[model samples]
Target: MAIGVAAGVSVGTVISPYAGAALADDAAGPSYLLVGGTGSSNIGVLRESGGRLIPVGQPVPTDTGTLSITVTPNGRFAYVAHTVSGTLQGFRVGDDGTLERLEGAHLAPGRPIVGAVVSPDGKWLFATVGSVTNDVQTYAIAPSGALTHVDSVTIPGATSGLSIPVVSPDGRFLFAPSFIGATMDSYAIGFDGRLTPTGSQVPTGDRPALPSVTPNGKFLYITNEGTDDVSGYRIAPDGALNPIGRFPTKAIPHGMAITPDGRYLYLPQTGGQSVNGFEIRDDGALVPVPGAEAPSAPGHLPGRVVLSPDAQRLYVIDTLTTTGTAKVFTYRVKPNGGLEATAELPVDTGVTFSDGATGVFASLGPA
Candidate 1:
């Protein structure tokens, strides 16, 4: 399974199906960073390079309350939702990048799943029973990774919380975000991975929370966290959404990280502890990446933000740190997109940052 290899350590080998494209930084292969939240029932795993992030081997339990993590574009497998144990676990990517608990695979959608994603062709694994079941479930990803449910879709006007849907790097379209019901829901990804409501919902600006999509799937961004700003859209070849407006940010913004040729875009701002940056205008407007903002460290709060599938580096995820501990900063992705802090991985003392929680989750395993 060659996913982030480490077991006996000897990366001096060969196994390329693009070898999962080396999970992220691939200086020949070795990439990982998984963290888990609500204080950790164990998931941590680190081990990237250039931008640092070390720790790999130890924390890997999972079964208390993780809230989000879904790596499987061939990085073996990783599921892990668990909104207070509503369950989802599954893991099995141990070349050396550790993590092995996948016994019966786990599953459990009884309620409160909170977030999970995986369809760029790793079969399917969507999941987000969001706040008390606003719906969006679908499973089916067996080839040993387990998980079979396959269908649920009910997000029409869900006025409460939790959101983690985004899946359109050509996997068709999924884009969910309905947190507090500001709206932003578009689907149409079925060939078996059921979910088809390209009815497009739209509206968003007051609490929309998270949803990022670019890398050529056109544009989609949406981080409204109760209106600090960032809503822009334009993915309509059928997957609906066409707004392209509200873009202010730096008050709450939550998480987002795009760049792999889709221009820039970073935004972290858990109540503005900072980490802005943008620049993706072809029509889906959003300018302001000149120096890339970035601020957190004083009181520390930045929620989730990733990039480093060779986009250089730029990972934030500070649910708390300033001593309370749960850090994972790292930057250096400047070719004009700015941001150069570089290095800061602490995590494991009760990871805190809430509201659509997503503590951290990079990939590229196989070294």
Candidate 2:
């Protein structure tokens, strides 16, 4: 059956495949989604009806490229990383999942910021910032969706670029991979949103970049963009990382998303224009999924791959082209871990910026 999602319309129970167990939610049809785009304009929000993304309200403007977006667990607010400008922007999520601009809700933590992620508890926001600043910034989230800067901490022994930051599903640790440093940095997130390093750094293959924690919170994975591989680690109780092993990939793997059940890991290789799948073992090792290589068109530059709330669909955000014809490619995850392309939704990004590409995620919630 084709997956149809609605946002802010009604609440229903959904048994998500990603969570292994039956995760109860009020609704199966989630309403709103937001995608950040680069160009002269700001990012836009999309209303989900019948599983498709349609523009809503007005496009909220931000400086340069809105590289990444993070929404609160309750779906009340969204925060975006304006990478080019080294800043953060906020929006109040409407009841129907619409986005309303939040004025005076910007955070300037210095230049060359990369990723922004809100804590699972929805109390804190964390982001990676300036290559020279060499720090991760944390902020306290206000009830109105505005952010109040709290603290910043540098990755241990970090001497290069920082890609993005990921908080463990347990919200106990924040993982930031230093691109050139070849080190996986860990920080213990305090109850009040402050940060403290885990004392030691976990080494990686090459440019140990993007880090994603499994939904089960048992393991951590980092993509080595410089070495064309990925590394897995065992998460210690004290938020330390112990290297499991390294796995090869198609090419230049950047972004990764795991299934809700914690059974699979999906990596989107921007340079390869293909997604590689791996079956996660019970012990935190990665095994390649047979016949799970999903490819896209040549210039798609598919970077970010995300699964819908129901885990029935995976959306690949193909960064914009020079002529403004980029698209968001949708696929249906087969029963056997393979992917079948379903739809290529057109997006108007106007122009492409080489700095970085942004992505959109379709939301599911009650109307």
Candidate 3:
């Protein structure tokens, strides 16, 4: 049977045979895992062939209930943060793009693990512990891709707050967004991977959800889920957040991503069930991308937005349904940072075979 889903100006087809065969490619690419509140914890391997997303292997079972995931820069390791268990799990990527469980399955620090990221050097891992404790934990990543506990420091106002941590591209700073405190806190990273607060917290909008640093390492963007806006900040040399501007967006701007060239920022509005694009000016102001808002189907809670490594395609994950379904939206990014939709591919996470919460595209790296 063939399934037809809306892609922007036209309809895209998903044939069962093609999907099944695509799932058998040898170079099906690295496995992308998705974790959430449901019990659907599995890894998806995708191959970008013929300008299409081809699934190569079957999903592997990861027992840890992951709320978020981050893959290492080398794509050899994937770390998942479990919200309920308050731990992190490490998995090694095999040749076939399958995941092999490492020794560190559930390393908990007495708090819920909301976000985790590998350092730019791939030497250390940091995770945000979203507990009343309000601490960011550090771990030394072994050569075998295992994590060893290193140290942790508490954010002064992070207690009972949702601190989302992100490491800068230069490997010099780590920024954590505190929802309850309404602040974006900065920390200077020591050579040994220890974090020391930089004594600066730039206040942000209500309920800041996720923080993203531009690829150029010059600016930071945070999504305010409660306010339906995105706040931009200029990165100071001393690891300080200098407010650039706050731009209004659709309702519930949950997930966001900056293009590879650092010219465009994509926001996925969960409540509005739409995707909005913005052009980044040289002065750190965001101008809404013309003709970029695409309506989504009902119950399509867009969770995360990511661009292809080549910067040719845009992908959004829908999180409302239990069956994993990713709305793969392709776009032709113009020279001026505007976006035009090319096609949309609806991928089944092997849940319904027709439509269901299959899995989310957690992170996208090169093939």
Top TM-score model: 2
Residue runs of model 2 more than 4 Å from their true location after superposition:
1-29, 39-41, 57-59, 158-160, 320-323, 343-357, 360-367
Tens digits of per-residue lDDT for model 3 on 1-367? Answer: 1111211111112222234343354253533434233244444455554456655455444433455567677677777676555566677654344555677534755456766777888898988775554678889888777788788887776343667678999899999887777788899999999998885778888888888889889999999888889989999988888998899988888768788778889877888888888888998999988777767656566766666655666666665644444344456656665566666556644321111112234332342
Deviating ranges (above 4 Å) for candidate 1: 1-3, 6-78, 81-100, 104-123, 126-145, 148-172, 175-187, 194-229, 234-237, 256-271, 274-298, 304-317, 327-367
So what's the TM-score on candidate 3? 0.83
TM-score of 2: 0.84
| lDDT for position 65 in model 3 | 44
> In model 1, what is the error at residue 248, expressed in angstroms?
0.9
lDDT of each: 0.71, 0.69, 0.67
Model 1, CA-based lDDT: 0.71
Ranking by TM-score: 2, 3, 1
- Ranking by lDDT, best first? 1, 2, 3
My TM-score estimates for the predictions, one after another, are: 0.34, 0.84, 0.83
User: Which window of ten consecutive residues has the lowest lDDT sum in model 2?
Assistant: 1-10
Which digits, one per residue and each the tens of the lDDT, describe model 1 over residues 1-367? 0111111211112222323433455555566777675555555666666666666645555655666787887676777776666677777765556666665567665566778898887898888775633688888888888888877978876373577777998898888886766777888998998988886487888877778888889888888877799888888888898887888877888778888888888878887798888889789799987778878878778778778657788877776556664677777888888887754644443444333545445454342
How many residue pairs of model 2 clash at the backbone? 16
